[model samples]
Target: MAFDTKLKQWTSLGLGTVLMTGALAGCGEATKPADTPAAAEVSETEANSHAGGDHHGAEADAAAPATEAGEGEGGVTIEAAYTDPVVYKSAIAIAAAHVLAARDAYAEGKTEAAAEMFAHPVSEVLFDMEPVFASQGVEDFTGLFSDTSAAVFAGESQEQINARTDEILAALDKAAESAPETDMSDAMVSASVASDQIERASDMYVLSIDSDFYETYLDGYGFYKAAELTFSQNEAAIEAENANAASAIRSALALLAEAYPTALRPDSLDADASALAVAASEVQLELSQ
Candidate 1:
């Protein structure tokens, strides 16, 4: 599950760059400076056609000095760069940088701080639904009590859930103490942190289930509706929460580590990174279910 969450965050954050870049074209922010090579590659003939009289007539009246002066500049001037296909700008690059930085923090064991990098939109989605899931019993959610749900509640029993969770914590303590002496580079660290963020969402599943709760409260739709509220309020967070199932994943990883510290071998986090990306996509899908 942690694998899934981490993969999802990475994937969504990655794809978000594309979506944001595309959207930014409408706002005229995705365009880079005229001097930038990305902008320079545009053929003047093609550019001139795009910067035709009709397009500039309205802007000519209200054009700022910079816009007016730049109009005559040659080889894809910034003012003339506004039409059609949007180019990648520094803003998209900056967003990518932040995500990379956050991921670095996590891999280095700065778990608390690393969490701050979580996409807020995803957080909002999960925050709204989590409380409701905790409050409602499975019994009330007959429509939702199925294979997927069962897997989600795999270790919900009092004896197994708490016990297994405790084991994982203990293992993490050991890992922190025994981790290899290699220094983590910025990129490696960021990827690892992102992995942890997605992995943490499992907590919701662990805490929400109770054997008896399922007997009396069985309205899956009601619980699902609560999740929907979460998505509406904060889609990003909800996505993260759902993908990582951090609580449950951490517990499971910890328990597995206790038995065999290398069970999931997160030390080599490439696999985990990919999984985190996928988990994010799944989280979005799960909310609909």
Candidate 2:
């Protein structure tokens, strides 16, 4: 049987059921979007960029969705949204994405928020994945996450933080060497992670409709960022295999970027997040072929 099929069967009991993306949120110094899509954190240029692009260009744009914004929901944590079946390498990549987000936030003076993204994953799953790493002859590097989180909290300079980020990211890469072999194509795996994140992002957007949606909005923001990065990394392969599927993924990412414009929720919510879901659904159909 295909690994994904078996993975789905194995994960059905735990993956979707855990639904604790929430644990990832409000975790940074305790931290912590909107209408017209402009009410969010987006620039007019970013808003315009989503209009069109070739496969590679669109994929790049998707991954670079500016913070002038925003994830859809299940507590909205990228850790929960994208790593269910636990593609070891991709899970580590997701961790890298969170670190990148934290790096950017700290550069922008949002240190507390930075700390949250930096530390949560170590507790969430990175440490627990030790067995897989040990089995593969990889050492425990999860401690780096906590250490880096502390540095960011301590007001480390951007240069220092950048170095720390690089260090941890390198460790993650080494650990990914242990990711179990799978029957699925790399395109299939990347696409699957993208789909999971967008699905969760859609759910989070719905929850953001509430008047008390601060943390809820932040959750969605993280998911969207991670989703874009996941899809962009393997984009060329996915495009070569199925041009239509790749296009749909880009379109959905553009929609997600608009919906999740920033960490700060707007006073008025004005996004048709369903459009994002429909776009993701189209990509799924393409993948099923």
Per TM-score, the best of the predicted structures is 2
lDDT of each: 0.25, 0.56
Worst 10 residues of 1 by lDDT: 84-93
lDDT of 1 at 135: 31
Score residue 159 of candidate 2 by CA lDDT.
100
True lDDT of residue 50, candidate 1:
25
Cα displacement (Å) at residue 245, model 1: 20
Candidate 2 Cα outliers beyond 4 Å, as residue runs: 1-86, 211-213
What are the C-alpha RMSDs, in order, of all predicted structures? 25.3, 13.7
* CA lDDT, candidate 1, residue 200: 27
Question: What's the TM-score of each model vs. the native?
Answer: 0.16, 0.65
Cα lDDT tens digits, model 1, 1-289, are 3323432442344322322221111001122222322111112232233221111112221221232333221111232122211101111111222223223333444322222222211111221122222232101111111111122223234343234323432432232232222443322322232332322222211211221221001111111222222223344442454544333333333332232222111322222323433553344343334
Instruction: Tell me the TM-score of model 2.
Output: 0.65
